[model samples]
Target: MSAPIPNRVHYHKRDRELELGYPDGESYRLPIELLRVYSPSAEVQGHHPSEAVLQTGKRNVGLLNITQTGRYALKLHFDDGHDTGLYTWEYLHDMATHQQAWWENYLTRLERAGASRDSGVIQIHQV
Candidate 1:
Protein backbone atom coordinates (compact mmCIF):
# COMPACT_ATOMS: atom_id res chain seq x y z
CA MET A 1 0.00 0.00 0.00
CA SER A 2 1.16 3.52 -0.79
CA ALA A 3 1.84 5.94 2.01
CA PRO A 4 -0.42 8.88 2.62
CA ILE A 5 0.74 12.25 1.39
CA PRO A 6 0.47 15.07 3.87
CA ASN A 7 -1.94 17.79 2.88
CA ARG A 8 -0.52 20.31 5.31
CA VAL A 9 2.95 20.99 6.58
CA HIS A 10 4.01 23.50 9.17
CA TYR A 11 7.25 24.15 10.95
CA HIS A 12 6.90 25.21 14.58
CA LYS A 13 9.84 27.39 15.48
CA ARG A 14 9.21 27.52 19.20
CA ASP A 15 8.65 23.78 19.51
CA ARG A 16 11.30 22.94 16.90
CA GLU A 17 9.13 20.47 15.05
CA LEU A 18 7.51 19.80 11.71
CA GLU A 19 3.79 19.13 11.90
CA LEU A 20 2.24 17.04 9.14
CA GLY A 21 -1.50 16.91 8.66
CA TYR A 22 -3.18 14.22 6.61
CA PRO A 23 -6.52 14.11 4.88
CA ASP A 24 -7.74 11.29 7.13
CA GLY A 25 -7.39 13.65 10.13
CA GLU A 26 -4.25 12.05 11.50
CA SER A 27 -1.35 14.34 12.30
CA TYR A 28 2.18 13.98 13.56
CA ARG A 29 4.74 16.33 15.02
CA LEU A 30 8.27 15.36 14.08
CA PRO A 31 11.05 16.88 16.09
CA ILE A 32 13.76 18.84 14.28
CA GLU A 33 16.45 17.07 16.26
CA LEU A 34 15.05 13.69 15.20
CA LEU A 35 14.95 14.69 11.56
CA ARG A 36 18.52 15.96 11.65
CA VAL A 37 19.98 12.88 13.28
CA TYR A 38 18.06 10.55 10.98
CA SER A 39 18.64 12.52 7.78
CA PRO A 40 18.79 10.35 4.65
CA SER A 41 21.70 12.18 3.06
CA ALA A 42 24.75 10.21 2.10
CA GLU A 43 26.71 12.18 4.66
CA VAL A 44 24.45 10.85 7.39
CA GLN A 45 23.21 7.50 6.06
CA GLY A 46 26.35 6.73 4.11
CA HIS A 47 26.67 4.38 1.15
CA HIS A 48 25.86 1.36 3.33
CA PRO A 49 23.97 0.71 6.52
CA SER A 50 27.04 -0.44 8.46
CA GLU A 51 28.86 2.68 7.33
CA ALA A 52 26.21 5.03 8.64
CA VAL A 53 27.57 7.92 10.67
CA LEU A 54 26.50 8.59 14.19
CA GLN A 55 25.15 12.13 14.54
CA THR A 56 25.94 13.91 17.78
CA GLY A 57 25.67 17.43 19.18
CA LYS A 58 22.55 18.17 17.15
CA ARG A 59 20.13 19.25 19.88
CA ASN A 60 20.42 22.88 18.81
CA VAL A 61 20.28 22.32 15.09
CA GLY A 62 17.54 24.26 13.34
CA LEU A 63 15.31 23.37 10.42
CA LEU A 64 15.93 26.30 8.11
CA ASN A 65 13.55 25.46 5.29
CA ILE A 66 11.45 22.83 3.54
CA THR A 67 10.96 22.77 -0.19
CA GLN A 68 9.33 20.44 -2.65
CA THR A 69 11.41 18.20 -4.88
CA GLY A 70 9.28 17.49 -7.96
CA ARG A 71 6.35 16.35 -5.82
CA TYR A 72 8.04 13.15 -4.72
CA ALA A 73 10.11 14.48 -1.83
CA LEU A 74 11.08 17.41 0.35
CA LYS A 75 14.46 19.04 0.51
CA LEU A 76 15.24 19.90 4.10
CA HIS A 77 17.55 22.79 4.84
CA PHE A 78 19.26 22.84 8.18
CA ASP A 79 20.96 25.69 10.04
CA ASP A 80 23.94 23.41 10.58
CA GLY A 81 24.51 23.55 6.78
CA HIS A 82 23.06 20.09 6.10
CA ASP A 83 20.72 20.28 3.15
CA THR A 84 21.36 17.09 1.23
CA GLY A 85 18.62 14.82 2.55
CA LEU A 86 15.59 14.28 0.39
CA TYR A 87 12.65 13.17 2.49
CA THR A 88 10.17 11.32 0.31
CA TRP A 89 6.49 11.04 1.16
CA GLU A 90 6.78 7.38 1.97
CA TYR A 91 9.82 7.98 4.14
CA LEU A 92 8.13 10.78 6.03
CA HIS A 93 5.02 8.74 6.65
CA ASP A 94 7.01 5.78 7.85
CA MET A 95 9.18 7.96 10.04
CA ALA A 96 6.21 9.54 11.69
CA THR A 97 4.46 6.22 12.15
CA HIS A 98 7.42 4.51 13.77
CA GLN A 99 9.08 7.50 15.34
CA GLN A 100 8.92 6.23 18.87
CA ALA A 101 10.70 2.97 18.18
CA TRP A 102 13.24 4.64 15.92
CA TRP A 103 13.92 7.33 18.50
CA GLU A 104 14.59 4.77 21.20
CA ASN A 105 17.00 2.97 18.85
CA TYR A 106 18.80 6.23 18.19
CA LEU A 107 19.20 6.75 21.90
CA THR A 108 20.59 3.28 22.29
CA ARG A 109 23.13 3.84 19.55
CA LEU A 110 24.19 7.13 21.09
CA GLU A 111 24.62 5.56 24.46
CA ARG A 112 26.73 2.76 23.03
CA ALA A 113 28.97 5.34 21.39
CA GLY A 114 29.13 7.61 24.41
CA ALA A 115 27.64 10.43 22.41
CA SER A 116 25.76 13.48 23.59
CA ARG A 117 22.98 15.38 21.89
CA ASP A 118 24.20 18.70 23.29
CA SER A 119 26.68 20.66 21.23
CA GLY A 120 30.41 20.42 21.85
CA VAL A 121 30.12 17.67 24.42
CA ILE A 122 31.52 14.53 22.83
CA GLN A 123 32.87 11.69 24.90
CA ILE A 124 35.87 10.02 23.38
CA HIS A 125 35.54 6.29 23.27
CA GLN A 126 38.74 4.25 23.55
CA VAL A 127 38.64 1.42 21.08
Candidate 2:
Protein backbone atom coordinates (compact mmCIF):
# COMPACT_ATOMS: atom_id res chain seq x y z
CA MET A 1 0.00 0.00 0.00
CA SER A 2 1.17 3.50 -0.77
CA ALA A 3 1.75 5.95 2.07
CA PRO A 4 -0.71 8.76 2.52
CA ILE A 5 0.61 12.19 1.70
CA PRO A 6 0.12 14.92 4.24
CA ASN A 7 -1.68 17.97 2.95
CA ARG A 8 -0.68 20.17 5.84
CA VAL A 9 1.23 19.97 9.10
CA HIS A 10 0.52 22.15 12.08
CA TYR A 11 2.17 22.12 15.45
CA HIS A 12 0.06 23.26 18.37
CA LYS A 13 2.41 24.66 20.94
CA ARG A 14 -0.03 24.59 23.82
CA ASP A 15 -1.14 21.05 23.10
CA ARG A 16 2.27 19.79 22.03
CA GLU A 17 0.58 17.88 19.25
CA LEU A 18 1.65 17.70 15.62
CA GLU A 19 -1.48 17.75 13.54
CA LEU A 20 -1.07 16.04 10.21
CA GLY A 21 -3.82 16.59 7.69
CA TYR A 22 -4.22 14.42 4.64
CA PRO A 23 -6.02 14.95 1.36
CA ASP A 24 -8.44 12.14 2.13
CA GLY A 25 -10.09 14.12 4.96
CA GLU A 26 -8.04 12.31 7.60
CA SER A 27 -5.88 13.79 10.29
CA TYR A 28 -3.68 12.57 13.14
CA ARG A 29 -2.45 14.29 16.25
CA LEU A 30 1.00 13.03 17.14
CA PRO A 31 2.40 13.97 20.50
CA ILE A 32 5.85 15.53 20.73
CA GLU A 33 7.01 12.98 23.26
CA LEU A 34 6.06 10.11 21.00
CA LEU A 35 7.95 11.64 18.09
CA ARG A 36 11.01 12.14 20.22
CA VAL A 37 11.07 8.65 21.67
CA TYR A 38 10.43 7.01 18.33
CA SER A 39 12.87 9.14 16.35
CA PRO A 40 14.12 7.38 13.21
CA SER A 41 17.74 8.31 13.80
CA ALA A 42 20.70 6.07 14.34
CA GLU A 43 21.21 7.83 17.65
CA VAL A 44 17.93 6.44 18.87
CA GLN A 45 17.24 3.34 16.74
CA GLY A 46 20.95 2.45 16.71
CA HIS A 47 22.78 0.20 14.30
CA HIS A 48 21.16 -3.01 15.52
CA PRO A 49 18.17 -4.13 17.55
CA SER A 50 20.42 -4.87 20.52
CA GLU A 51 21.93 -1.39 20.34
CA ALA A 52 18.65 0.53 20.34
CA VAL A 53 18.67 3.32 22.91
CA LEU A 54 15.77 3.82 25.25
CA GLN A 55 14.77 7.47 25.53
CA THR A 56 13.75 8.87 28.92
CA GLY A 57 12.84 12.25 30.42
CA LYS A 58 11.20 13.34 27.18
CA ARG A 59 7.63 13.69 28.36
CA ASN A 60 7.70 17.46 27.86
CA VAL A 61 9.88 17.67 24.80
CA GLY A 62 8.96 20.15 22.07
CA LEU A 63 9.46 20.45 18.34
CA LEU A 64 11.75 23.27 17.39
CA ASN A 65 11.52 23.20 13.62
CA ILE A 66 10.54 21.13 10.60
CA THR A 67 12.48 21.20 7.37
CA GLN A 68 11.35 19.54 4.20
CA THR A 69 13.66 16.78 3.01
CA GLY A 70 12.64 16.52 -0.61
CA ARG A 71 9.17 15.11 -1.20
CA TYR A 72 9.61 12.07 1.00
CA ALA A 73 10.37 13.30 4.51
CA LEU A 74 10.79 16.16 6.97
CA LYS A 75 13.75 16.69 9.24
CA LEU A 76 12.55 17.23 12.77
CA HIS A 77 14.42 19.69 14.96
CA PHE A 78 13.65 18.96 18.58
CA ASP A 79 14.18 21.18 21.60
CA ASP A 80 16.25 18.54 23.35
CA GLY A 81 19.23 18.97 21.07
CA HIS A 82 18.05 16.22 18.75
CA ASP A 83 17.71 17.19 15.09
CA THR A 84 18.72 14.13 13.15
CA GLY A 85 15.43 12.27 12.78
CA LEU A 86 13.88 12.52 9.36
CA TYR A 87 10.18 11.88 9.75
CA THR A 88 8.75 10.31 6.64
CA TRP A 89 5.08 10.42 5.81
CA GLU A 90 4.81 6.64 6.08
CA TYR A 91 6.57 6.54 9.44
CA LEU A 92 4.44 9.32 10.87
CA HIS A 93 1.27 7.64 9.72
CA ASP A 94 2.31 4.34 11.24
CA MET A 95 3.19 5.99 14.54
CA ALA A 96 -0.15 7.76 14.69
CA THR A 97 -2.00 4.57 13.88
CA HIS A 98 -0.23 2.53 16.58
CA GLN A 99 0.39 5.25 19.13
CA GLN A 100 -1.44 3.50 21.94
CA ALA A 101 0.42 0.22 21.70
CA TRP A 102 3.76 1.93 21.15
CA TRP A 103 3.28 4.22 24.13
CA GLU A 104 2.27 1.35 26.36
CA ASN A 105 5.37 -0.57 25.34
CA TYR A 106 7.56 2.44 26.04
CA LEU A 107 6.05 2.88 29.48
CA THR A 108 6.57 -0.79 30.23
CA ARG A 109 10.23 -0.55 29.32
CA LEU A 110 10.63 2.52 31.50
CA GLU A 111 9.06 0.74 34.42
CA ARG A 112 11.37 -2.22 33.99
CA ALA A 113 14.39 0.09 34.00
CA GLY A 114 13.09 2.20 36.90
CA ALA A 115 13.26 5.27 34.71
CA SER A 116 11.01 8.28 35.15
CA ARG A 117 9.77 10.52 32.40
CA ASP A 118 9.86 13.42 34.80
CA SER A 119 13.46 14.45 34.29
CA GLY A 120 14.66 11.07 35.48
CA VAL A 121 13.54 11.84 39.02
CA ILE A 122 13.66 8.65 41.01
CA GLN A 123 10.67 8.38 43.26
CA ILE A 124 11.05 6.71 46.62
CA HIS A 125 8.21 4.55 47.84
CA GLN A 126 8.08 3.31 51.39
CA VAL A 127 7.49 -0.40 51.48
Candidate 3:
Protein backbone atom coordinates (compact mmCIF):
# COMPACT_ATOMS: atom_id res chain seq x y z
CA MET A 1 0.00 0.00 0.00
CA SER A 2 1.14 3.53 -0.74
CA ALA A 3 1.46 6.22 1.89
CA PRO A 4 -1.34 8.74 2.23
CA ILE A 5 -0.56 11.90 0.37
CA PRO A 6 -1.12 15.37 1.78
CA ASN A 7 -3.53 17.68 0.04
CA ARG A 8 -2.77 21.12 -1.28
CA VAL A 9 -5.00 23.71 0.36
CA HIS A 10 -5.84 27.21 -0.81
CA TYR A 11 -7.94 30.05 0.48
CA HIS A 12 -9.87 32.35 -1.84
CA LYS A 13 -10.78 35.53 0.00
CA ARG A 14 -12.89 37.04 -2.77
CA ASP A 15 -15.14 34.03 -2.94
CA ARG A 16 -14.81 33.21 0.75
CA GLU A 17 -13.89 29.62 0.00
CA LEU A 18 -11.21 27.24 1.15
CA GLU A 19 -10.18 24.71 -1.46
CA LEU A 20 -8.37 21.45 -0.89
CA GLY A 21 -6.66 19.49 -3.62
CA TYR A 22 -5.89 15.90 -2.89
CA PRO A 23 -3.27 13.72 -4.48
CA ASP A 24 -6.00 11.44 -5.77
CA GLY A 25 -7.15 14.38 -7.94
CA GLU A 26 -10.13 15.27 -5.78
CA SER A 27 -10.96 18.80 -4.66
CA TYR A 28 -13.44 20.41 -2.30
CA ARG A 29 -14.55 23.93 -1.48
CA LEU A 30 -15.67 24.97 1.98
CA PRO A 31 -17.25 28.34 2.73
CA ILE A 32 -15.95 30.80 5.30
CA GLU A 33 -19.25 30.95 7.17
CA LEU A 34 -19.24 27.24 7.72
CA LEU A 35 -15.70 27.33 9.02
CA ARG A 36 -16.39 30.12 11.51
CA VAL A 37 -19.43 28.57 13.18
CA TYR A 38 -17.75 25.15 13.35
CA SER A 39 -14.66 26.56 14.99
CA PRO A 40 -13.00 24.33 17.62
CA SER A 41 -12.51 27.04 20.24
CA ALA A 42 -13.81 26.42 23.74
CA GLU A 43 -16.03 29.47 23.33
CA VAL A 44 -17.68 27.84 20.39
CA GLN A 45 -17.41 24.18 21.29
CA GLY A 46 -17.45 24.58 25.09
CA HIS A 47 -15.78 22.02 27.39
CA HIS A 48 -17.85 19.09 26.22
CA PRO A 49 -20.01 18.16 23.27
CA SER A 50 -23.18 18.51 25.35
CA GLU A 51 -22.13 22.01 26.35
CA ALA A 52 -21.91 23.27 22.79
CA VAL A 53 -24.00 26.42 22.43
CA LEU A 54 -25.58 27.10 19.10
CA GLN A 55 -24.02 30.05 17.35
CA THR A 56 -26.39 32.63 15.89
CA GLY A 57 -26.40 36.03 14.14
CA LYS A 58 -23.32 35.17 12.12
CA ARG A 59 -24.73 35.11 8.62
CA ASN A 60 -22.58 38.02 7.50
CA VAL A 61 -19.54 37.11 9.56
CA GLY A 62 -16.17 36.96 7.86
CA LEU A 63 -12.62 35.96 8.66
CA LEU A 64 -10.49 38.62 10.28
CA ASN A 65 -7.24 36.72 10.75
CA ILE A 66 -5.74 33.22 10.72
CA THR A 67 -2.79 32.58 12.98
CA GLN A 68 -0.88 29.35 12.98
CA THR A 69 -0.98 27.47 16.27
CA GLY A 70 2.19 25.49 15.80
CA ARG A 71 2.30 23.15 12.83
CA TYR A 72 -0.81 21.21 13.70
CA ALA A 73 -3.56 23.82 13.94
CA LEU A 74 -4.74 27.32 13.14
CA LYS A 75 -6.37 29.99 15.31
CA LEU A 76 -9.07 31.76 13.34
CA HIS A 77 -10.29 35.19 14.34
CA PHE A 78 -13.73 36.15 13.16
CA ASP A 79 -14.78 39.72 12.49
CA ASP A 80 -17.32 39.59 15.31
CA GLY A 81 -14.59 39.60 17.97
CA HIS A 82 -14.66 35.80 18.26
CA ASP A 83 -11.05 34.67 18.37
CA THR A 84 -11.13 31.56 20.46
CA GLY A 85 -11.34 28.38 18.30
CA LEU A 86 -8.26 26.39 17.51
CA TYR A 87 -8.87 24.49 14.26
CA THR A 88 -6.59 21.56 13.74
CA TRP A 89 -5.81 20.43 10.21
CA GLU A 90 -7.63 17.15 10.66
CA TYR A 91 -10.68 18.85 12.13
CA LEU A 92 -10.81 21.38 9.33
CA HIS A 93 -10.57 18.60 6.77
CA ASP A 94 -13.35 16.66 8.45
CA MET A 95 -15.57 19.74 8.55
CA ALA A 96 -15.00 20.33 4.88
CA THR A 97 -15.75 16.74 4.03
CA HIS A 98 -18.91 16.56 6.09
CA GLN A 99 -20.18 20.07 5.58
CA GLN A 100 -23.44 19.06 3.94
CA ALA A 101 -24.46 16.53 6.56
CA TRP A 102 -23.40 18.79 9.41
CA TRP A 103 -25.27 21.77 8.00
CA GLU A 104 -28.47 19.78 7.54
CA ASN A 105 -28.23 18.50 11.07
CA TYR A 106 -27.67 22.00 12.39
CA LEU A 107 -30.69 23.36 10.55
CA THR A 108 -32.85 20.54 11.83
CA ARG A 109 -31.63 21.12 15.36
CA LEU A 110 -32.40 24.83 15.13
CA GLU A 111 -35.90 24.19 13.81
CA ARG A 112 -36.63 21.66 16.50
CA ALA A 113 -35.39 24.08 19.14
CA GLY A 114 -37.37 26.99 17.64
CA ALA A 115 -34.16 28.94 17.27
CA SER A 116 -33.21 31.42 14.63
CA ARG A 117 -29.70 31.93 13.42
CA ASP A 118 -30.29 35.67 13.33
CA SER A 119 -31.59 35.95 16.85
CA GLY A 120 -29.54 38.58 18.67
CA VAL A 121 -30.32 37.59 22.21
CA ILE A 122 -27.66 36.90 24.80
CA GLN A 123 -28.94 35.02 27.81
CA ILE A 124 -26.82 35.67 30.87
CA HIS A 125 -27.34 35.32 34.60
CA GLN A 126 -25.35 35.76 37.77
CA VAL A 127 -25.41 33.43 40.73
For candidate 3, write residues 21-93 as lDDT tens digits. Answer: 7688877887777777777878778899998878766666777777778777777777788888887777876
> Residues 29-52, candidate 2, lDDT per residue (tens digit)?
999999999899999999888888
TM-score of each candidate structure, all chains considered together: 0.94, 0.94, 0.76
- Local accuracy of candidate 1 as per-residue lDDT tens digits, 21-118: 99999999999999999999999999999989999999888888899999788899999999999999999999999999989989999998888989
Model 2, which residues run further than 4 Å from truth?
A: 125-127
Between candidates 1 and 3, name the one with more favorable lDDT. Answer: 1
Off by over 4 Å in 1: 124-127
Comparing candidate 1 with candidate 3, which one achieves the higher TM-score? 1
Task: Give the candidate order by descending TM-score.
Answer: 1, 2, 3
Deviation from native of the Cα of residue 47 in model 2, angstroms: 0.8
State the lDDT at 31 in candidate 3. Answer: 77
Against the true structure, candidate 3 reaches a TM-score of 0.76
TM-score of 2: 0.94
Question: In candidate 1, which residue pairs clash?
Answer: none
Evaluate model 1: give its lDDT: 0.93
Cα lDDT of all candidates, in order?
0.93, 0.90, 0.73
